[model samples]
Target: MTYPPPGSGYPGPQGPYPPAPPPAPPGPGYGSPHGGGKTNGLAIAAFVTGLLGCFGVVGIILGAISLGQIGRTGDRGRGFAVAGIILSCLWIAAGITIGVIAANSDSSGGSGAAPSATRTKPKEVDAQKMKVGDCINDNTTASAPSTAEPVEVESVKIVPCTSPHDGEVMAVFRLSGLTMPPESQLRQRASDGCKIRTRSRISRDPAANSLANSYYYPTDESWRSGDRSVTCVAVAANEGTKLTRPLAR
Candidate 1:
């Protein structure tokens, strides 16, 4: 090979490499790698809320916003955003299915009308408000024979005459008293008044033989509270028996 002078600039075998092309200006959008960037804040929030299932719609909105941001800014968490959206959709679908099933179950349960139509139970009424011909039942002892002890009751349930019942009101009478009568005298007065009032009615009913007269009288407290009315009821004569037909009919 020929040699040039010591101070002269000379080309090498490759003739001095190209200038390096200004380092190629770095490729477009060439920052950190896709998953190496900062994590997307909305993506984290969406994932946490979606796992709870209570904020499904909110999670979906946040996930969509995160996905858009991730595409534009090349941030991390793309998989988290997509998973959040999918989980949110699944939770919403499950909630809708449960609601539909509950609605259908309720609709099916109340479809029948026969049970409510022929119901024997009726509204309750105050015992003091019992009127003649009102068929009634109470929570006291089942039987109310003529000789049975007095029952302390606040209310009674009025039922149909055809339904089985404990008692049926035959008459109502009032006792005149300026003060509470003695217990014995009170019972006597109530018993006398009820018997006198129900005597004629009992004679007319052919089924009266199966019935017995019972009376409701006011207590000392009730008498002080301005209650002076007494009610006469015809009940089954036998203990533990329920009257099936109206005594007056």
Candidate 2:
């Protein structure tokens, strides 16, 4: 074997063989930088897949994570993340809009409120607003209505009493007969049922053997409704008055 000397164009087998030409360009350092682009593409694909599916919300979350990773590593998932976020927001907005629309549609079933232990009462019912000769009846102890009777003259009012007991005072009258003042100005002294003879005189009569007084309530509606009268006693101005009358049948 002939050994070549240094500077003779022949390796002397003493140093590192000229570094081996950098190992053939390192076979494309980093396995083809194209891999980074692929990572970003995969991220975008995943985001789209998630958005189109029912898992849009999940997609958004995953996309966000991928985007974060891309920012940190220069990876390929950024597109996916952005798409997911947009779709997720749209879904959320749709749900909210639907809720608002349903609420305002005026459906009886749509009414809602947290259940409260407190009982709510019905509002006041004004029977007086009935037609001139119409009688109104309530569902509770209040008497059924009778037809109203508009008398020939408007001067007379039939102020009637019911059971001769004042509904308001919670007390019964000792005697019967009109409790009104001599002058007919204040036609009805006691208002048991609030019925009035718009054009008739009011008279009270004690029950034939019962401690009850009957006040006559005359109205044109009562007469028309085939009801001649209502018996009610005067009501006191001050009594823990009923907040409202029960609903009428």
Candidate 3:
């Protein structure tokens, strides 16, 4: 073999390869191994808002927007968006159901019904049949009896005074005439009579301050139906308290 001179054919290794061409600039969809797309921000928001019941509607709208964004931008979190939408839908449905039930209860006079431990239906009775010292539950729609309008007594349940009762009858009196008086005059008379009766029955005590008088009198329709008696009752000043004894003098 002929010997070649050193440094002539293989150039003595003075320069190293050229630094490898700068690593090829990392290709098309590079940095993240999974994909270059980001997780959708609106998708995350929708999920968080859905967990809070009050914002369920808003969450549904946001979840829809997130799905559109993910479809176009190749973003992640489609599962989150779907879950948020489902949760929001269920929340709305529950709210609607509760509202319907509440509306039905109000329409059926359930709001005016007395609280009974036994849940017995109120018994219908003539207004004249209510006597003094009777503990009764008045299931009438009228919150306060008015002389202007005939207050119809729908039903009454006579319960023991010791048990939970609505009101205690203090006095029973007659308006005394074939013709009914004006509503304002009748209301005034009923109010005055109830006040007198309550004062006469209850002595000056702290409980007296918390006692209020209510009266039921004949309306024009009731008067035509042969109802003439006015029933006075002593009730708690605030709701949820029962008159546990006769309030009459």
Model 3 spans > 4 angstroms off: 1-124, 141-151, 204-206, 245-249
lDDT of model 3 at position 101: 93
Measured against the true structure, the TM-scores of the candidates, in listed sequence, are: 0.51, 0.34, 0.44
Query: Scored by Cα lDDT, where does model 3 land?
Result: 0.74
Ranked by TM-score, top first:
1, 3, 2
RMSD of candidates 1 onward, in order: 13.7, 15.9, 16.3
Q: Which structure is stronger by lDDT: 1 or 3?
A: 1
Query: What lDDT is reached at residue 238 by model 1?
Result: 85
List the pairs of residues colliding in candidate 3.
Answer: none
Q: lDDT per residue, candidate 3, 1-249, as tens digits?
A: 877887557644566545445566755654543667788999988888887868959989999999999888778888889888888888899999999999998667586776555544445566568888777876553323222244567557887776677777778887777888998888788878777766766555347777777788777888898887778877777755666665535
Expressed as tens digits, the lDDT of each residue in 114-228 for candidate 2 is: 3232323222333332222222223333331222221222222211122122221112222234332332322244343333421121223121122222233434443445433
Model 3 residue 95 distance off true place after TM-score fit, in angstroms: 69
Q: What TM-score does model 3 achieve against the real structure? A: 0.44
Which candidate do you rate higher for TM-score, 2 or 3?
3
lDDT of 1 by residue, 151-236 (tens): 68888999988888888898898889688888888888888888898888887889778778888889888888999999988887
Give Cα-based local distance difference scores for all models. Answer: 0.83, 0.40, 0.74
Number of the top lDDT candidate: 1
What is the Cα-based lDDT of residue 224 in candidate 3? 94
